[model samples]
Target chain A: MEFSSKLLQNAVHEMSQLPGIGKRTALRLVLHLLKQPEERTEHLSNALVKLKSEVNFCKKCHNISDTELCEICASTKRDGTVVCVVEDIRDVMAIENTSQYNGLYHVLGGKISPMEGVGPQDLNITSLVQRVKEGTIKELIFALSSTMEGDTTNFYIYRQLEGTEVATSTIARGISVGDELEYADEVTLGRSILNRVPFESSIKAT
Target chain B: MEFSSKLLQNAVHEMSQLPGIGKRTALRLVLHLLKQPEERTEHLSNALVKLKSEVNFCKKCHNISDTELCEICASTKRDGTVVCVVEDIRDVMAIENTSQYNGLYHVLGGKISPMEGVGPQDLNITSLVQRVKEGTIKELIFALSSTMEGDTTNFYIYRQLEGTEVATSTIARGISVGDELEYADEVTLGRSILNRVPFESSIKAT
Candidate 1:
């Protein structure tokens, strides 16, 4: 193929390694870069190069940050008494987008999967226990997925903080979303029935 | 979002700016990068930064190259007397993959689209005319598309080289591919029939 330059060809090859991008798409992107002002490509390249060099993990919550601590961990307005545990940074983004909770987060990096050879030792469980040992945290929320590995990880963390004052809770999976009572799955319906709340406010919207 | 590091966010943001990539896809790509060693991200970043800085256009044919001339232009075995003009570098790769043509190529970068405000001046047409005037080229093949803009660009170039000794030609378009004779459009079928070669030559396998 008659590439305009060796550097362009090399860039296309590198880009083609990405998921869903073929040689043609890569070439198109390179050609587009050629048409754009040099600054745009420079911006992207600088960002990429500085990504690992300038950025570091927040020592407290594992969120990305320019400094030692993430904004959430460094903020006094956030509830430090409540800790929401998750499997990865993506879950933190999901929770943040909802804007429902104002508590802190603990990213485990991954869930426990015995078959995959990843156990509690491979996760950030020790650091989490050290947080609970500080004695100010009241509730430990397990916002993990309902998958088997996620459940296993949740149970492991629950057992670790069993004797502590931190009362553990998990996100309920019943009545989810837009489904009516009749349309709910049997397992979900059963879970909802078992975890039913006591009547305090009128359901008829008085 | 709880990112592993600040670089992760920056990388994802840059990736998301590409033509079709979205936030989630960018995040996925960044996450994949994090899983690999430092060299992977560094390699890609270096390639991107060096793409424009290290490469320039081939002065003679306008193809991409590290030197003043591209591989096709530099190759001694390729047909220097014939020039195939195309809309973009992707077309160069497509034709090269066929291994059927050994002629040189000229990349126009784009077709002349009045709606997009692209004119002849914006393209590499002047260089093409200069090349024709040099008197080394014989066949000037217009391998551009059959669309209105493509046709207009071809006609414009044809007019520009009117007095030159070079013989201008357009690539044939007919009932493309596996199209049945019954379903073929009138224009295509008529052209195919009118341009049909002698049965004796095509009957024997090449």
Candidate 2:
């Protein structure tokens, strides 16, 4: 779109460079900023710049953190011996929200997607192997999504920890608690049947 | 959502404040930025700050500009006597894209929407009246949307120009060029029929 001002056009161009945002959307966002108080724009820009430049990643888990170690890694209350492996910080946040697992986390940053040119070396796999070799972790839970890339990443890590004495397992895939079995996808339903839990164990949750 | 870093949380919160963006999308965008090179984030932030702080509006038409007068207003090729009144800069860009009209524009900034607590005084209506009073404009075309607020704004401006020598007109509302008559809304179809142009006049354009 033709913008009257070069500054406005530049802002829109930069905004549209973001994933999922188009030129029209960028224009709308820029115009919205233009209509608001100058401080709002200043706050947004400053926040983005600060987040990019000064943000720190946890040395232990590779998750976003303000300190050298993330909160979960530093917390003595959490089960440091049990580590939940995830693709990114969002997965860490999602699992944290559930409050179901109390283990420490290992963020791989991303899965092993060959089609996307992302290999095992591209991720935080080397550090994860180092963590396992240190012999502190007892159980390594594979909590990545049930996709080919996720499975590949899990296997790659499992191979790296071959000589280590850590127990490795994946999170169970089954029908959601409230979802109707009939409405479930065929693959999920089939998997749930094949990986059926013990009757007494399922009953104890209720 | 709980973020390990306060900086990440602040950036996500600010990003979510933009129209049509939600918390999840905001997180996705923030994480995408975090994964990219630092220069991308710096470019986006710097451009936004520059645009917000340095952008200017045309003195005559009130459209966004880098100078006192906008390109359209300063151009000798465009019809200075005929002015198109629009809601905002987007409309100016939309009309410019069509390349159908060679006239100047006057941006109203926004329509008079009582539901949103926006009134005539809140807009650039006063400057529009001042433009009309200067007696250079011979025709004023209302190109705002076909909403109730748009009609209200047009009528309000028309009333303001009651004693002026300029002729006023609204852009026609009808079936779009490629739209089927069967699918056209009743009001639009009825209006199109009522304000039907002569067959020869319509045929001449093709």
Candidate 3:
């Protein structure tokens, strides 16, 4: 798209470089910023700059943090023996929101997607294996999504801990809590049946 | 959503302030930036800040420009007697792409929408009326969208220039160039029929 001003064009071009944002969307967003108070743009730019320069990744879990070790890894209340493995900080946040697990988290940073040229080594897999081998974590729960890439990542990590003391488990696959049983995918329904737990245990957990 | 880091939250919040971006998309974009080289973030932030600080609006037409007068307004080859009144620079670019209009443009900045608390006073209507009253412009083509707000803004400007010598007209409303007539909306089809141009003129123009 033709822009009247070089400055506007530059800003839109930079914005469009983001994933899922096209040139038209970038122009719309940049124009919206121009229509707003100057401080709005300042705040946005300043925040991005500050975050990029100052934010830290936890040395222990690789989660985004304000310090060397993230809060969950450093907290005394969270169970260090059980570590929930996730794709990124977003997953960490999602699991934290459910209030279901009080275990610590290990951020894989990304999945093993060969189609995108992202292999096991491209993520934080080595550090995770090192942590598990250190004998601190007793159980490793696979909380990645149910995509093929997610499964490959899980199996890769599970194989890495072949002779280790850490027990490996995956999050349940089933119909959603409020979804109709008929609408469940065949693979998920079959897995749910095969992995069925005791009725009393499910009742107690609920 | 809960964030593991305060800096991450602040950055996401600022990113989400842009129009049409929500918290999830903001987080995704921010995370994508984090995953990219630090220079990517630096470039994006710097471009936005530079654009906000240094961008200028053409003094004559209010179109975004690097100089006091935009290229269209400064060009002597263009017809100063005819000005196309539009909502903003986007419309100006759209019209310029058509390569049909060789006249100057007067940007209104926005439309008259009471629901959004935007009235004629909030727009660039006053200077436009003053420009027409100066007796330089002979005709104004209303190139604003055909929305209710666009029509209201057009009528508002038309009333403001009541005693002026300028003749006013609107862009045509009809089936798009390649659109099937059977699928055309009733309002636009009826208007196209009522304002039909001579078959000979249409053939010659095509």
* lDDT score, candidate 1, position B76: 99
- Residue pair clashes in candidate 1: A3-B64, A4-B64, A4-B65, A5-B64, A5-B65, A51-B7
**Which is superior by TM-score, 1 or 3?**
3
Candidate 2 wrong stretches, greater than 4 Å:
none
Q: List the residue pairs that clash in candidate 3.
A: none
Candidate 2 residues B85-170, lDDT tens each? 99999999999998889989999899999999999999999998998899999999999999999999999999999988999999
lDDT of 3 by residue, A1-206 (tens): 88889999999999999999999999999999999999999999989989999989999999999988988989999999999999989898888988999999889999999899998878999999999999989999999998999999999999998899898888988777888889998998899999998999989977
lDDT of 3 at B51: 95
Question: Model 1 chain B, poorest ten-residue lDDT window?
Answer: B1-10
Q: For this target, which candidate reaches the highest DockQ against the unseen true structure? A: 2
* Candidate 3 overall lDDT versus native: 0.93
Stretch of 10 with least lDDT, candidate 3 chain B: B156-165
Report the C-alpha lDDT of model 2 over A19-70, residue by residue, as the tens digit.
9999999999999999999999989989998999999999999999999998
* Docking band of candidate 1: medium
